[model samples]
Target: MSAKDRIAVFPSRMAQTIMKARLKGAQKGHSLLKKKSDALQMRFRMILKKIVDTKSLMGDVMKEASFSLAEAKFTSGDFNAIVLQNVTKAQIKVKCKKDNVAGVTLPVFESYQDGSDVHELAGLARGGQQLAKLKKSYARAIQLLVDLASLQTSFITLDEVIKITNRRVNALEHVVIPKIENTLMYIISELDEMEREEFFRLKKIQEKKKKIKAAEEQLKQTRRAMGIDVDNDGPNLFAEQHDEDLLF
Candidate 1:
């Protein structure tokens, strides 16, 4: 592979060790993100189911509320203004909470009611039972609406979360992990090449040492064959001179 394709690091055993560790970490991260994506996708499907069911129920609840309102107005003669006048504060409220699923935080909307009565439902009930029925029907409709909204919101949020998580998983699986592994291979190859070169160099040095030792041994053998001391003898100036008295 081209040098640019692999990561640039000093080619050494230490660098190889680090790259192996990085590869392991990448693999681990990929596995975890894959699990997270699967979990988020499961939750996404559940929310989608809830949204469909809630929407279907919404139509019925709203229709019932409309019929109840009509019945209440016919029985009590349009008492909306009277009920509004008595209202001081809202009784039913929506409280928001967070739910964690597969490391993702999801928003949960809950409907709640205060301890006090809702407006003048009791006094209005005295006019006719239809007003109380209307109250219950509309409350049911409102709760359904809140539930639908919560489901839709969670659905959208989870979709985005799942997309992001899947992207990360794909990156690690296809890109990051491969790059690290390739770099590790490169480091290992470089280290192997270095070792081979070192071995060759050591072999050459030993060969040269052996040649030098053999040359010295041959020189000493030649000196002993000529009856010259190899180490202790020095040059004798008159050793080759013919003696005059011996010649007469």
Candidate 2:
């Protein structure tokens, strides 16, 4: 009755057939899930590498952006107020799409420019060169941030999916399939025992029939030797009349 010992199944040929089918299905499922786990692990490693590289670049990108902002500030007065006044709509946008990897759906983020750059002309009036440099540095930083976010999200998702897949694989491999096989072995052994019992019964019946036939043949031979009728139509096998036992 233990879960690992055997599955709850009837001990019959039909039950054995069913268990075989179930074992096949479990094995196939385990194989597919194992492959899926491998795929997810691979993706997780790639994402981890990307995150590490992106993080390493993050500090430098942020430093460059800060230096550009400082240079622009020193060259001219506060330009943030001017930019805030001119800012109306977003020129940069992110769109999401589903990416499938070994049956798992992952959301992929992509950044794109939706509209023309707003600051193309702002630098023409004052600190033109420094403002342009600052804009470039910040744009680079934003792109890096977007990439990092995408990598981190994928990493977490893959990690969770891999764990689930491995659990399923283990269950099918170690528990479900083994239990089904044990049930099959039980069914086969029971069937073989039944067949053996039937054979023994039939053998006993045949032996009894042979003994009956031999006794009838010996009786016929004894009647003929005693000079008694032995023909099938002459008399019964058991003679009842005798001169010595007759009394009138």
Candidate 3:
């Protein structure tokens, strides 16, 4: 490899060991990410189904409400319009509580219709049956909007959250995890090569030391046989006689 392409500093043995541990941790994290993605996807599908169904029902509810309002309009004064005026801006207090799903909250709303002190003339009709039907239809429409609005909002929120979560999971599964693994493999391979080189170097040094010690012993034996005093660096007649008497 070119100098510029190669790594400037090699990792120590400890670093390679740490990388192996990190690889294992990354694998575990990848599995958890997969589970999270699956769960969010499942939730998305369910919410999508609900939104479709609710919309379909909402259309029918609106149609029935329109027809009912028209009937009431023909029978009596503009009572339908007045009821709408009173109800549209009415209080719709909602209390939110989170469910098991992540990033999702359920909205509980207070009923807007007033029945206790409401004037019967407010939902006036041609007859008692017609008046009752009009009131019932109006209530039905209000309830539908309440139910549909809450569910639709939740569906939209879930869709956004799921999109973000899936992106992260894909990054971990397809990009981040792979990069970490590649780095770990490279570190391990380099560390192995360094270990082998160090082992060979130590072996050569040990052999050289052994050879020098052997040569020194042989020289000492030769000096004694020749009646030379190696340490004193001199030959002596008395030493020669002493060497002859000494055991090998």
Candidate 4:
């Protein structure tokens, strides 16, 4: 918005004081937002780095898990039967929590070992050794997935918060601050114009008083030349001149 459009027009000392206070507040807000943006940006970079590392690690874990599953299927004539036997209960459970990073709360997922002996039953069958190895590999994959989920969630949350903070900072720096400063200049200029007008008005009044005083002094001089008393509290020259003209 333009400065004039953004500012309120109030040309008075009270308005000036209020505007100054508002300007101070805007400046303080801008400073705080700048600091907040800086902090969030720092955290965003850290989270981004972690996400990259986690993704790379996830790829490796997924590949290992796939290879282990294939080996288990080759060694155990019926790997599907083993999976069915072990499908009774989950061995890992996910718990969710919140973590605060630079004023932004992010979700964190953790995996905990659940109470289930399904893996032990899977080992009771043929090729139980390969089945066990496959189970361990899958367990490692689950743990990595949980960690990756947490990192991904935190990364997205931080990115959004950083975007919002940046918008606020830019608005204050580009729009709000300049508008307040423009309004302040307008108020000062208006007050100065009022002062100048008042000075000119007073000057005119003083000049009119001086002209009146000069006219009264000239009237006194004329009456004195006609021998009329200057301070007499009576009808003066104009009346006396009228009387003499009537007699003639």
TM-score of each: 0.83, 0.86, 0.73, 0.83
Candidate 4: clashing pairs of residues = none
Q: Using TM-score as the measure, which candidate wins? A: 2
- Candidate 1 steric clashes: 0
Candidate 3 C-alpha lDDT tens digits along 120-213: 5554335445566766776777777766676666667767777777787787777666765666667777778889999999999899878876
Ranking by TM-score: 2, 1, 4, 3
Q: Residues 40-87, candidate 2, lDDT per residue (tens digit)?
A: 888888889889999999999999999999999998778888899888
lDDT by residue (tens digit), candidate 1, 19-95: 98898899989988998998999889989998988888889889999999888788778777877887888888999
The order of the candidates by lDDT, greatest first, is 2, 1, 4, 3
All-Cα superposition RMSD per candidate: 10.4, 8.7, 7.8, 8.6
Q: After superposition, how far is residue 24 of candidate 4 from its true place, in Å?
A: 1.3
What are the per-residue Cα lDDT tens digits for candidate 4 across 127-176? 78887888788888889889888888888888888889899989999988
Q: Can you tell me which runs of candidate 3 are displaced by over 4 Å?
A: 1-10, 77-97, 103-117, 121-125, 221-225, 229-248
- Against the true structure, candidate 1 reaches a TM-score of 0.83
**How high is the CA lDDT of each candidate model?**
0.85, 0.85, 0.67, 0.83
Q: What is the lDDT of residue 221 in candidate 3?
A: 93
Q: What is the lDDT of residue 129 in candidate 4?
A: 81
Lowest lDDT block of 10, candidate 2? 232-241
